[model samples]
Target: MPIPRIHEIMEADQRILNAFSPEKLHRLGQAIGLNDSTTVLDLACGKAEMLATWARDYGISGLGVDFSEVFVADARDRVRELGVADRITIEYGDARNFSPRQRFDVACCIGATWIGNGVEGTIELLRQSVTTQGLMLIGEPFWRKAPTAEESVEMGFSADEFSSSLHELVARFTACDLDVVEMFISSEDDWDRYVAPKWLTMRRWLEDNPHDPMFDEVRAELTNSQLSYTRYQRDMLGWGIFGLLER
Candidate 1:
């Protein structure tokens, strides 16, 4: 069986994804010049929060694609609940190879660039979804400063794989012929919002499945991550939502 996803354990608390406030999303929309008729493709869209927000707030029509069946169903339910089912469609598919019949005015890959293997590769992948003069939004992690090799390894990055500085990140976009249009940086609070709840959810799951052998591995991984995060990443790294346009 495939390893269980973190979301599988905390499916009950959908609010955890609300780390990006509506206001922040609206600001991102404005930065990207979203409109009532904009067609967006959300790559690796988890629960379709960004898609739902855009449909409701900006009147943009879009499709959200994700690999998780549970997340796709949740996103579909959210679209129905918001009464914007007509504006947003949710699909279960891999973002790396999804191809839509229609092109999009905007394409987004938020915090899941692994779909493209890496930053430059993700930009290339998103370009296939965009129409002429369209916007591409990439949410990525960057170091606030150079991290020690030890710090990189502690943060789950290979010594050679971690980005050394923010400039390197921007350089990758520039090299891909993508212009940096706007960005929203995530604060420490945002990281907390995304990660802290995992602990509680995992603890509850462990209580309910005390005899499950996998829980031991999950517990150990979570504990190590929690301690390492507090010790190393809390103030060391940063993430941002970047809006890029074709040069």
Candidate 2:
């Protein structure tokens, strides 16, 4: 199954696709000190919810780049619905190859760091798009408690897939010449909000598209996700959005 199609089915009802709430997202924008003059560059911006909401609330202008045709369309619609079309631009393309003519005041790679390979490389990528001392917002996952090799394998993750702890995650930023100014750690409630909705969405999709080519795969994926969430993810996994200032 196509990755984008899988995401489309799972997150059909979600706007901010990461394990974040609208309130927390807005608080993050405030913590970062957004204003009318702020220029932002959002990479892998699913639905562009952060940009759209910030534009409405803070009057910030920005560009959002995404690869998912489904998400790009929804993002465009979201901007228009929010009446921030004049402040936000949604671009459809590979974020890894995006080259901005002018650096932005903020650069974000929320929940989609694979565009630059991983955390370290992603920090480097975002750095190139922002002005000196600009902020970089990175949404990353970490281990709440270290899992054994067996558990890691069962989670379909490599040994180095995530930072060992939240402190380690901050250290990774410092190693790249960035300062962790602030962070918003997702609570278990946030995790539930992000994961539970997918079950219903996937089930409904399966019911309506029994004859679809990707039906079986989607069902199996959904089953695995439910099992994994119950068995390991809920307690062992954690996610956070870190605000980093270039040093």
Off by over 4 Å in 2: 1-3
- Specify the poorest-scoring 10-residue window by lDDT in model 2: 1-10
Candidate 2, residues 119-222: lDDT per residue as tens digits?
99898889899999789999999999888898877777765789999989889899998889999999999999999999999999999999999899899988
What overall lDDT goes with each candidate model? 0.80, 0.92
TM-score, per-candidate, Cα-based: 0.91, 0.97
True-structure lDDT of candidate 2: 0.92
TM-score between model 1 and native: 0.91
Name the regions of candidate 1 deviating beyond 4 angstroms: 1-4, 10-12, 15-19
In angstroms, the error of model 2 at 101 is: 1.5
Deviation from native of the Cα of residue 197 in model 2, angstroms = 0.1
lDDT tens readout by residue for model 1, 144-247: 66667787777786544546667888888898887898879887787887777777777788788888866777788679779877987777777888889988
Backbone clashes, each candidate? 0, 0
